[model samples]
Target: MEPIIHGILLAFGLILPLGVQNIFVFTQGVTQSNFIKALPAAITAAICDTLLIVLAILGLSLIVLQFDWLRIILVVAGILFLVYMGKVIWTSPAANNKETVALSMKKQILFALSVSLLNPHALLDTIGVIGTSAVKYSRQDQLLFTYACIVVSWFWFFGLATFGAVLKKVTIPQGVFLLFNKSSAVFIWGTAIYLLIGLWQGAY
Candidate 1:
């Protein structure tokens, strides 16, 4: 019971942060023609996150913690990727059209994978936080913890997609849409800078 409560709180704490995965999932939801259109992206994000969480529990987190060089490399790569993504978001062609081009399921899934799996921050959080938490649990408890975390990822993504769909039906203002895009860019860029600084601090 203790593990369950902690796991739920911990999972929500981690997922509530607006990183690339969360931002993209919500964006797809709000932008897609129908709420169901965003389903692939949300599910894909959950799957990728589950893989990371499982790996974290299986000891990949320990390996990452042991190697400072590896952490630095991941941070650098993430920074570059995020910068490019931020630019793309800011200049998205949908700015002038509420009925933006709808993405195919394949594209949404692929984008979800790139943001969830390839994002260094997501990887590190899984490896460090989830892994660390697992260490305190017995095998059975660990399984419970993992299960709780996975469930949160799935529900949170779906909820975000649903919220976006609901917002669309209510008719979001054009300025709000523009603001979301701009805010998303800023969030991504800010995350990159935060990761860089964290690396610098850790190195010293």
Candidate 2:
């Protein structure tokens, strides 16, 4: 019971931070014509998290992520990708957005996977936090903890998507979505710059 509760709390703590993955899910929710249309993003993000959590707990990180150079590579790749995405978002014309339809499931899944899998912080959280925490538990307790964590990921995504959907009542969704894209661009660029500075300072 304690382990279950601990897992939930840990997951919440790790995921509550504003990051690329969370923002992706939230933006999908806001831009999608309906909450149902946002499911692909939520599901894909959750699936990526599930894979990370399982592999982290199974000690794959110890085997494959032992090299500092590998971590650096991931950091560099993530930064480059984020910077490009930020520019795309910031430069997208708002006038064309009103006619935009909900994202196809394929695009949603791909985008979700990109943000969820590529984020260096998410990888660290999986290995450093979830993996470490699971090591202290018995096999049965580990299963319970893992399940709780997975559930939290799914719930959080849906909750975020729901919040986005709710905004439809307050104003024009296309305008709100365009505004969100700009905000998301700022966030992505800020994160990229922070990562670059951190790497320069050997903060990683």
Q: What tens-digit string does per-residue lDDT give for candidate 2 at 121-157?
A: 7897787656655554567887898999999988988
Per-residue lDDT over 176-198 for candidate 1, one digit per residue giving the tens place of the 0 to 100 score: 65666676577666655655675
Instruction: Write out the backbone clash pairs for model 2.
Output: none
- Model 2 Cα shift for residue 82 (angstroms): 24
TM-score, cand. 2 vs. native: 0.63
Q: Estimated TM-score per prediction?
A: 0.64, 0.63
Q: How many clashing residue pairs, candidate 2? A: 0
State which candidate has the highest lDDT.
2
